[model samples]
Target: MIRTVVVAGALLLGIGVVAAQQDALKSAQAIMKANGKSLGGVLGPMNKGEKPYDQAAVNEALNTLDDTAKKLPTMFPESIKGMKAEGDYSPSSKIWEDKAGFTASIATFAKTVTDAKASVKDLNTLKAAFPAIGKSCGGCHETFRVKNS
Candidate 1:
């Protein structure tokens, strides 16, 4: 009976580690998504012609996005020392499930961000950048993120 209890405790601990990691990843993703939405809201007026594209405002938005992008790599759960595997609820498996496709999607995203950042000076150029930006996000969400859950 004591041995059985010990085994069960170990199993629970392992599962807890995995679950915690998943939670951390999910939290990071949520943070990024929230940041994106906030920036998008700020940029929308200029894009929609509701307000003139203010270079200062646009630059601010882009700077925020650049910061967000820089923080992205750290959020990924590549490794966590001392964390035990408890359970798993990540989209990592899906993200890498089709390795080639995933790589292409991420590459496209990076390129889109790079182009958008570089073209921040001109409203017309910024407008042009929107499609690529949206496409990059849509591609990842469709494949890696869970549907509406």
Candidate 2:
């Protein structure tokens, strides 16, 4: 009876840990999605030339992206790789398996955002810098993120 109780307790503890990891994953994914929305809101109109670019809006969006980039690497700790919760987008296992590579990609993205933020003084500069920043993001996503369809 004692052995059975101990086994049951261990199982419950494992489940709890998985649940916590799933929750963390969900939170991280949500942050990334929100950041993406912010980027899209600013960049979409700029790209389409639908309206005159607003420097203040570009700066604000880049700041948000930079902040999120800084947080991205730490968000996907090893424990949460395969775990999923409601609305969670699971990262590729490559993130944990090739952690060094993943970290480098994130560092590159952060640097790209920083450089873009620094160089974006006017609409023309922003238009020039945005594509490079986007490429950096796309490179990381191609490797570390799962494609949702």
Candidate 3:
């Protein structure tokens, strides 16, 4: 009876770890998707506006982006380092092949937001900064991420 209880407890612990990782992964993806959508919406309206841009809104957006970048690394799949090389379980080869580039892309995005937080008080400054940040994100998507379609 004691041995059975011990085995059951171990199984539960293993499941708990996997479940926690999955929950974390899902939350991170949701955050990334929502943040991407928010950025797109801001850019679309800002580009077509003839009126002066809202500095407060731009700053708020930048703040959100900065937060996301800081949270990005923790979202990596828990099995990334231990997956079978020949199976469908390996981490993206691009990530391993160009680790420095991957890090740099995210770092650049974070820096853009940090700078934008300070420069967004002016419409012209924000106009310049916003496009630069968008380009960094686009660069990453072009090289590393695949589209769902």
Candidate 4:
């Protein structure tokens, strides 16, 4: 019957939408993971003197994060809009509510890293540069991310 075909088609469409959401979620997480590897894994240790600072490595990390900031917004589609952020760095539901603010936050991060790329010339400057980047990150997190719950 036509009704049966319509029902089946609707179900298939729903499933496809859900699959797309899952894929977007996975990609956003992977992008965050990569940024974390560069920021937390490498740069944090370098700042603490646990690892020797290399300017080339620092530049790479900054570049990577800047690139991420640009792409991160695309990961948050309308499909995922208003969805509660569950994980450590997942976006808050407010991301859709205040999309302009969310986007401004991303722009701030990109600007911070872009400025940092020029300022971080040596170990001492690297240390000096961290607080600004950290503030940029913390500001965004405070407004747009849900962590530890």
Tens-digit lDDT track of model 4 for 1-149: 99999999999999999888877877887887888788787788899999998888898889888888889689788787545444665667777889999888888888888888888898898899887887887787788767645
Model 2 bad stretches (over 4 Å)? 1-12, 84-89
Better candidate number, 1 or 3, judged by TM-score: 3
- Give lDDT tens digits, candidate 3, residues 38-67: 477664367457444676666666777888
Taking all chains together, the TM-score of candidate 2 against the true structure is 0.84
RMSD per prediction, one decimal? 5.7, 2.5, 4.8, 1.9
By TM-score, the best candidate is: 4
The global C-alpha lDDT for each of the candidates, from Candidate 1 onward, is 0.65, 0.81, 0.67, 0.82
- Candidate 1 achieves a global lDDT of 0.65
Pitting candidate 1 against candidate 3, the one with the higher lDDT is: 3
Badly placed stretches (over 4 Å) of model 4 are 84-89
Q: How big is the positional error of residue 52 in model 2, measured in Å on the Cα after superposition?
A: 3.3
TM-score per candidate: 0.66, 0.84, 0.75, 0.88
Evaluated at residue 34, the lDDT of candidate 4 is: 82
